[model samples]
Target chain A: MVPKLWNETIEEHRRAVREAVLETTAALVAEQGLRGVTMSRIAEESGIGRATLYKYFPDVETIMVAWHERQIAGHLAELSELRDRPGTPGERLEAVLERYALIQQQRHGHAGELSALMHSGDHVTHAEQHLRHFVRELLTEGVQTGEVRDDVSPEELAGYCLHALAGAASLPSRAAVRRLVAVTLAGLRPQG
Target chain B: MVPKLWNETIEEHRRAVREAVLETTAALVAEQGLRGVTMSRIAEESGIGRATLYKYFPDVETIMVAWHERQIAGHLAELSELRDRPGTPGERLEAVLERYALIQQQRHGHAGELSALMHSGDHVTHAEQHLRHFVRELLTEGVQTGEVRDDVSPEELAGYCLHALAGAASLPSRAAVRRLVAVTLAGLRPQG
Candidate 1:
């Protein structure tokens, strides 16, 4: 029992260190361009030793990619939690989109130098598939409730919603983001 | 009269040379990325002397920007031409979107190393304004014809359409492109 508890404590400590490294890498990338991100700097900022940082990540790009993966996972979890909230399917979708747009707007805050890195990764395809699946399921539910148009497939509508909301990332204000979301939601209504 | 004729010939030659330089730069970037594009290589590919090439453009980045400007101008001209075609406003909008999707798909072919360069520039804002204005006008016409939703403002709907169709650029096939356009058009219909 004593050995098992010691191992669990060590695992918890390791996880904490890993999370700190990711957070430090992201903050450094946000404050400086990709060029300024280095293992030593990350170690200094994260309060970890250089040797320990090297054991966890080989290079800056790898650390950034790991950080991005965590961001994507966190976002997906948030969306899923929103999706399961008690509401009509359409209302849930609206809530999810509103949250998605806000997340996109925040991501755009790091657009100048990190935008390219954000877009170029294998994780993009996986994340896209997950998002499309999530939205399509909600759309199917909305269709059954007569809240969304039935002529178009849910797959197509999912694509439309994602693409339409993508520009919200670059919008100037929260009001503009909300307006864009309204326009997108209007597009989903049953046609006359 | 003789000097006037001579000046006309000189002006025509200068225009041809400028066009050739732009084409050559684009081809080089397509084949070898932005890094391989140099004045010497451009001169060699364009069948011009180094001195003449330098006379036309000062640096590789400048030449690339000029080439990008021309591409934007060409796309705008094509869209405007489609807008003026003999058809109902709805039909014209459909035709323009189909062509725009194809253009976007073509642009994606060069997205690897040049995508950032393609997106960044003052010209992008100008092109976006032109596109939004053109699409908004068409939506207004459709609204008048009772074919489009009057609940949302034309400007808002236009933004939705552009943002939605932008994803067609990355779709896997022409069939997918058509489906995305169909979904976008469906979104514009009057809501019950």
Candidate 2:
């Protein structure tokens, strides 16, 4: 029983170290361009020994990929939580878009390089499908509530919403992003 | 008068040679990747002497940039002509989206490389502003005609239209693109 408890504690510690390494690598990549980041620097910034860091991630590219995966996972989690929140269908969608835009705003610099990295992974395709499904479910709810246009299928609208909100990633300010979201939401209204 | 005509003929020849060089270089880059292209190969492929090609363009990158400029110029011309076509505002907008999607479809195989080239130019920014203005004018006309929602500024809706239609560049098929356009147009409708 004691050995099993010790093994569980060790697993928790390993997980924490992995998390620290991922965060540190992302911060380093943000401060310096992806080309400038190195394994030793990540080890130093993350406060893990070089040997330990190697055990967690073999190279800087792997760490960046892992960090991006974590970022995507976190976004999906937030979106799912918002989707379940108490509100009208339209309100929930608006909330999700605003939150999504804020996240885009937060990811200002290095977006081009980061996007290149993001798409180079197989995980991106899966993540995109997950995001599309999430948006489609919300749109279906909105249609049922008569808040969204029923002429178009939810799948098409979900694709439109994603493509439209993508512009928010490059918008200059939060106010601009909010305006962008408003325009996207306006697009979802039932036809007069 | 004879010398003046000779000078005009010389200028025309220079323009033809320049256009040929640009086209040949683009074709070569398409056949092979950018790294395989060189000034000698471009001159040979263009059927121009190496020295004359150098006079027109210093290297492969310059030729590629010039080719991209011509492509953008052609697109802008097509879009402007569509914008002034005799139709209802909504019809004009749909025509523009269809043409735009066709253009995207035509640019299928080398889109990644071409986009990389397209974004590396200052002219792309100018082209985007031109496109946004073109879409904005259509939205304004649609609003006046009661075919579009008037609550949002034409500028905001124009942004939405561009972002939403940008997805056409990556869609797999013509029918899918048509569906995307229809959904985007639905977004522009007056709210019920």
Candidate 3:
């Protein structure tokens, strides 16, 4: 039987190896398009043996899907943290939206190939659902406070915000993204 | 040389043939998926001889592109007509937004395959530019009439409206799409 400390050490080592593999593969894909990446190159760049790399991920497509999942999780966590941060409901919503817009902006050009590959899976659907739910909850809280428009359902309002902010992917600058967030926020305000 | 009346008749026939080919190809793509379509099949279904079909379009891809371009032209003409219709600036803007949302909602499920094929190339770029310009002009008119908020530039607000209404694609009903349009229009109203 393995000792507790040894088990923990092995788990930590496994995580480190996985992290290295994911990062190396992403860097390679970025430097050379997705078509140029291969399992051998990922293992070589990651400084892991090909056999061990195979144990971690079966192939480039699998590695890419895993990497995309991790990236999406990170983004969701970042948004969740902002949502949970101390602020008025309106302020928190703005913070969450601005961050989301910036993320979209940063992904603009680089997202083409990766997005085409990564956007179709079950994981993407789940993440979108989670994101919509997250924003809906925020809008619900704001509506309770009379900060958001009460006429539109929070669910519909959340969808509007997401689709509006998605245009950030084509925006030219951070300022433009902020303006988009502002306009979206304006739409959510109480109507006179 | 052909007589003048004969020349006119020949031109009319050419136009009719082109229209038939475009419409038949679109119908075929809709019935079967893009992969199931071919030039010979298009020729057979369009009832234009293979040689004549070849004179009009060399392949399925060219035919699809031509069809998409024509469809885009029709949509633009519809929007332009709404824009030019007699109404208050606010009313006209709402009309355009509502129609655009309905179009998006209608395209949701059926758009996947066709959009993937037709969304590239210079024609799409030109159409998007025309669409943005079209909306921007409407917003500018609304702003001049003090119906639209002046805090954001008409350009930015136009982007917001287009992006927001695009959410209608995922909406489940016409009422939901109209609600989305209302929320997007709300964003354009003059601020307190």
Candidate 4:
């Protein structure tokens, strides 16, 4: 027999618990450095019981992976908006960098723990893999359109883009971040 | 009253302690994530007294800063080497990217942690600030020579570069990272 809607409601409640765990982690990470964050700490800060926290995340890494996914969704949305603007490929890419840099500057301090955690060292989550695949698709599209060079693959270029922006996000201000983004785009200019 | 070698000895001793702390924290973070790192844990792992560790780092954040500086130093060295090679601006930039991307692939696990820590919540350290300055200088030089674009500022571009590469570093392999770099560089090409 199919599970009842009440069962479905229970699943919905389960998801909310997971999301609550992630949301609470994000806020805590944004506030305290990663060291300050703990499941117990999250439990305390989130006003959820430790048992509830445990029910949602097996460990800190699982909770963080969820949190990082949330940030990635936001960033991908920004990337789509940036890339979709009407302009030359160079201008669009530059705009993406500028916009990304600005956003990063705003989110830098607030994001350190999750950014550090979503990275390697923990098990690769589906969201991390999915985001990579999505970004790779974006790069491949850039190449197929002749908007990008064919020599280097989309994956490598995506690395360069992420590495540069990670550095940018930690800078002191939007102007500084924008300058970095602009120059990096310039550096990427295709040969004569 | 001559403390001739005293300062040098003290500096050397301090350097050794600092490196020990960084190495230990790097190991701990690799095994346990940045949150796994702590002053007491580092002191225990490194076999240094808690007081000694405190004398050097005062907290987890300062030690992280030192470690990040060490990681960036590697990238900067690779870039400097690539810049010295005989090539047109386009060639050099591509070469530098190739070299740097390789370094990133090799150092991903460790350096990726440094990045994650750099992003983890609260108070930007001097090392983070310095990395931005370094990227700015590199990009400014690229722009001035017309090897890179001038329309976008160096800082904005650097932000994108950091974000792309750091994200790529978490991917499974070198081939994947290289493709992303190529596509991004390709997109930087100027329209005829």
Interface RMSD of each: 3.1, 3.5, 2.8, 5.0
lDDT by residue for model 3 (A152-186), tens: 89999999998899788778989889988988888
Docking band of candidate 1: acceptable
Q: Between the candidate structures 1 and 2, which one is better when assessed by TM-score?
A: 1
Which stretches of candidate 4 lie above 4 Å from their native place? A1-61, A70-113, A138-148, A158-192, B2-61, B70-102, B119-123, B162-192
DockQ of candidate 3 is: 0.50
Q: Candidate 1 residues A1-192, lDDT tens each?
A: 579989999999989999999988878877875767889899999999999988888888777777776776788899999999999999999999999888877876443346445563323646657878999999999999999889778887888888888777667788878877877887788777
Model 3 Cα lDDT, one tens digit per residue, B1-192? 879999999999999999999888878877787767898898899899999999988888788777776776788999999989999999999999999999878765434456544542223546767888999998998899999998888988888888798788779999999889888888788777
lDDT of 2 by residue, A48-143 (tens): 999988888888777777777678778999999998999999999999988987786677666445654465333355666788899999999999
Chain A TM-scores in order: 0.88, 0.87, 0.88, 0.76
lDDT of each: 0.80, 0.78, 0.83, 0.67
What local lDDT does model 4 show for residue B21?
A: 87
Instruction: For candidate 1, report its TM-score.
Output: 0.81
Model 1 Cα shift for residue A9 (angstroms) = 4.8
Backbone clashes in model 3, listed as residue pairs: none
Return the TM-score for candidate 4, rounded to 2 decimals: 0.65
Q: What's the distance in Å from true for residue B43, model 4? A: 6.6
The candidate that wins on DockQ is 3
Q: Write the per-residue lDDT of candidate 2 for residues B83-150, one digit (tens) a residue.
A: 78899998998898778766765665553455444552223556667778888988899999998888
Looking at candidate 2 chain B, the ten consecutive residues that score lowest on lDDT are B115-124
